[model samples]
Target: MSSSHDTHAAHDAATSHGAHAEKKSMRLMLHVWRQRDPSAEGKFVTYKLDDVSPDMSFLEMLDVLNERLIAGGDEAIAFDHDCREGICGACSLTINGQPHGFESETTTCQIHMRRFEDGQTIYIEPFRANAFPVVKDLVVDRGAFDRIIAAGGFITARAGSAPDANALPVPQVAADAAMDAAACIGCGACVAACKNASAMLFVSAKVSHLALLPQGQAERNSRVLAMVEQMDKEGFGNCTNESECEAACPKGISVSNIARLNREYLRALASSD
Candidate 1:
């Protein structure tokens, strides 16, 4: 005995409720690399995650998985993370064979779960390089980069108050290039992406940032020489110009910096002779 108007209203309400119930949770199969320590052989462990939210970031999704593991009295998976804001570059995860889950110019922390489909199988691992030995499941030793920087990444100016901006008139091109190179967070993505596992991109970016500045002019020759030498001594492979490093870099550090590195090295050799 309901009026037609009431019937339509009920239908509308039912439709709304149906839509609300349709937001089904996403589930994914994760094959995570687990290693007890540096000497232990790593293996892929399968884990099923049934409550993944599309709104959660990749790192947040991992946090949920970890919570479940700990609640179940299982050892939590170890991974690196800092700032969770994409600036720290500590979330080093190779998602499905890609450095940062195939996102262009985006780090792992910047990638959200919505990009992946339900029932997708995700394979996560650490950055592989001889210089960057696996420290744990997903953590690797990146101390080699620190040593390369220490070799010659600084300008040995007298410590004092900030110099006047007008004291040095750097060209617009040089300033822009320097800023681009300085954007590198030392993530080692370049090494992970390169077939030869070269550290050229990272070394070149570090070299370019200082070489483009006026303060870096004093030790230009020596800085490139020392940094390159340290890079070689660290067991990093040689650059074959495959351009994979530039493609995998979250900062989009250009391969042109590698060319600049070569030129600087040549100049250093010529000057030394």
Candidate 2:
């Protein structure tokens, strides 16, 4: 063989060896629940993964596993994700009994494999809440949150020539407070983490955001009353003063918002008669 062809062959062999080595280096065990459908009984299935890069995000690791499953002619694990930047609140999972696992002030999509140790077994589960019914493996229908919002959480302003943003000159403190409440991404981590599955944190975050702002002033009384009533109607348990929701909140929304919601509800009822 010509020297040029021999050198090319040698390079290809080295490259192949390197790829094989990398694949061999990946090692971990994932115990994921397999639920064919909401009606189907689910159970934990063990999978041994090798050559997994520690740099990959947690969701990306799951993607790799799904690809392997598909190649093996098996059904892929189901999970929800959108944007993958921790902003959409679509990726919801409970890792090792903690919402969003290792990431602080972040969602499941933002958690990376670096948080885990090599050869460790990871347990992933869907966010559990009575109001959030499981649709598939690691995916739940959070439509309850939407219905609660629809009750009266938004301004009634219609589309038109929009008013100037600075026209109302909101106080800095109030605007900051409003922005803080608006930071909630509706991921339902607060609900899943709460022992009673109370949605007070989620509901109050929405209520307080608007209630603190002048634009939300007109419907203040009605909004708080309606939203809280809807939250209760959804069958979510009442907050029992346990602060689990606060600790598990990805957005770190304060429990004080719930207090504000209660105050607003009482005021609304007092004035209605």
Candidate 3:
């Protein structure tokens, strides 16, 4: 409705505002773990960042650090990230001793630099667990999770192609529970948070999600048994009921799934005997 002159002026104003916003920055200190590889001795190396943007996500801040290191002819810090929007669960840094930092119900990639204070020293480390050994700084081998899932996290039923939602006839409660357990992203924050580095939370979610559904009934008992057995064989420790796993989970996956896993394992054991 306006003249072309007014439109050009508005565009100029918006561009100026965006340029101004980008100028805002923060200073921070980072004590990041540095290890050449699994066999190398790891240590925390301090780096001072003078121009961090509050608008940057946590991973973006790391990207900036890597750029600076590359410019200085130094090896960049190694880390994991995929689908920076948080669905893939690949950003696995233990920031300030908290998995995914201070953010609640959010992944590390979803955490903004604004959550930190200016001039604060942040400690970053890879998720620590026997099953999740560090491959490099802030990157651990999560293949143990893949192995557990492969053990029996699925149904062997011959039910071909996906069925229509209405044909399933699943109860609302059961469907809701299944969907809730299915939300797990397999981030291993549970193992990192547990004192014993236990993977019960992760294993349980996989078990409960399928077991609660009718399609999972045929292999439910064996599924739990196989997954739990693999979880132990991977050198992961036992859950002592400390519940730190639930607290660190970005999805807030309930520990009640762990209890269901215990029951399923018991049932499987009794029947086998």
Residue pairs in clash, model 3: none
For residues 150-225, what per-residue lDDT tens digits would candidate 3 score against the true structure? 9985676667888786987889999999999999999999999999999999999999999999889988888888
Residue ranges of candidate 1 with Cα displaced over 4 Å: 1-23
- Candidate 2 per-residue lDDT, tens place, 209-264, comes to 99998888889999988988899999898899888888888788999999988898
Candidate achieving the largest lDDT: 3
Model 2 bad stretches (over 4 Å): 1-26
Poorly placed runs, candidate 3 (over 4 Å):
1-23
**lDDT: which is higher, 1 or 3?**
3
Candidate 1 lDDT, 1-273, residue by residue in tens: 112334553454456557654445689999999998999999999999998866567888989999999999988889888976667878788899888779888888877776788899999998889999999998899999999999995687654898788987999999999999989989899999999999999999999998998889888999999999999999999999999999999999999999999999998999953
Cα misplacement distance, residue 251 of candidate 1 (Å): 0.3
> Alpha-carbon error at 9 in model 1, in Å?
33
lDDT of 3: 0.88
Error of 3 at 135 (Å): 0.4
**Pairs of residues at least 3 apart in sequence or in different chains that clash in candidate 2:** 26-50, 26-51, 26-52
